[model samples]
Target: MLQKIIFIFLLVILVSCGQETQPKPYGELRLEYPKPHYKLFNSNSPFTFEYSDYAEITPAKKKDWYNLSYKKMKANVFITYFPIHNDFNLHLKEAEKMVYEHTIKASAIDTQSFSYPNHNVFGNFYQLQGQTASNIQFFVTDSTKHFVTANLYFNSRPKPDSLAPAIAYIKKDLEHMISTFKWK
Candidate 1:
């Protein structure tokens, strides 16, 4: 009976391990972001991030975006910086339009919505969802006399309930880029 039990346990393990599924490595992601116009330089200011050395930042030539990639994590992080006056409503509207247009062209956004402006960032984040809602996250920023827009894309479905943690992780890197972002 002991031998039979061992055999059954081994069979169960084999069956379970054979299943095909998406691999999500916690605290790590895989993406291919476009490059920024300029190389990022170190700053003494608090607005800097401690990125892993394995990561590379490059400017995206095909599109108007900056791509940051992590070799170790196999993730793509893209950022676009738009410069504008903060107090101008017209500029804000224009920025919003640019972000929406970009999103519409990039993904299948069946439903589009915007959130209240984040006072801290002096901008807002918009969410786009289709049948599966976990594929994209969009943001617009008009901070420090600069209009910055960003989009995070994933091959996986981006339902907030399921992809929230990964989205959160991506945002951390995006935030770092935004904070250190400068136009040359």
Candidate 2:
């Protein structure tokens, strides 16, 4: 009788467990961004660049400082201008220092040099990969009287895999801005 009861219990357990165990498949997100449209950023700040229509340029608290806010993307491109006044190397160091601050969280840092001799716009673009506070930081200077540095910051926490699409989208805009940058 006991053996019969045990057999019945085993059968019930086996029948109840009918589903096979399998690992869940990874998910991929399909995100699309609109084609970029640029507007000339001719300001009284002694510099001009063609910024994306998608962004709204707002002046920062300080003079000659501006924020290119991307409301839809929850990001901002901060532009800081400093008249060299014999401190060109100081400004350059500060910009580079800002980029290195994220080294602890960055998987890698890629540097790209850009030059538009016609416009006297020369700069270094830094792209930070991995979970970092800022993904991109760059500085453009004519190597004399005018120096400008910019940093791209997202409102959300850094998640490289999830943010890759948005990063790529904004990166193109930055490239366009750099290309059209002029010191006036």
Candidate 3:
């Protein structure tokens, strides 16, 4: 009787161990953007990143000027460009106003800034807290070269506790791009 009980326990453990415990893979996201232009700035900042091998970077087309201009992504990453200016602070103020006006349901606020004087680069990172989810806006400028503002929004509420990993990964790449930013 004891031998039979031991045999049954071992059998159950073996069967459970043999069962698959891994999650099924998910399908890739879909996105579309205009042409991409691969122009390099003066800085030596690296743009290395890890994502699915399926993503393609195309040139930013002339037709898509001022609208959302970006390289194709498996995810929806809309990048729009405004003209670069010598007075970057004014541009940042304008961006804040735009966010406040567009995101009517949210209370948008500037969180912090990171500056690199050696590269003449300055950036302000903002957080928009809505009734539901939150959004992020990054306003960057190379005082003598280029001015840029990037806003990232998603349907889900922006919970820092849950969104930290993805945000950190994307921010690293974004910072690389901003650090190397320049004007034609």
Q: Tell me, by lDDT, which candidate is best.
A: 2
lDDT of 3 by residue, 64-93 (tens): 222222222212233444555566667767
Ranked by lDDT from best down, the candidates are 2, 3, 1
Q: Alpha carbon lDDT of residue 22, candidate 2?
A: 89
Give per-residue CA lDDT, model 1, range 52-152, as digits (tens): 34457666763345566654434565655544545656666664665456454344443333322433344455545443322344454434554545555
Model 2, residue 147: C-alpha shift (Å): 0.6
Stretches off by above 4 angstroms in model 3 are 1-75, 85-90, 102-104, 107-110, 130-134, 155-165, 179-184
For candidate 2, what is the total of clashing residue pairs? 0
TM-score of each: 0.42, 0.86, 0.47
The weakest ten consecutive residues by lDDT in model 3 span 65-74
Model 1 stretches astray by more than 4 angstroms: 1-55, 62-65, 71-75, 85-91, 98-121, 126-144, 156-165, 176-184
Best by TM-score: 2
Considering only N, C-alpha and C atoms within 3 Å, which residue pairs clash in candidate 3? 35-59, 35-60, 36-58, 36-59, 36-60, 37-59, 37-60, 133-157, 134-158
Name the runs in model 2 displaced over 4 angstroms. Answer: 1-26
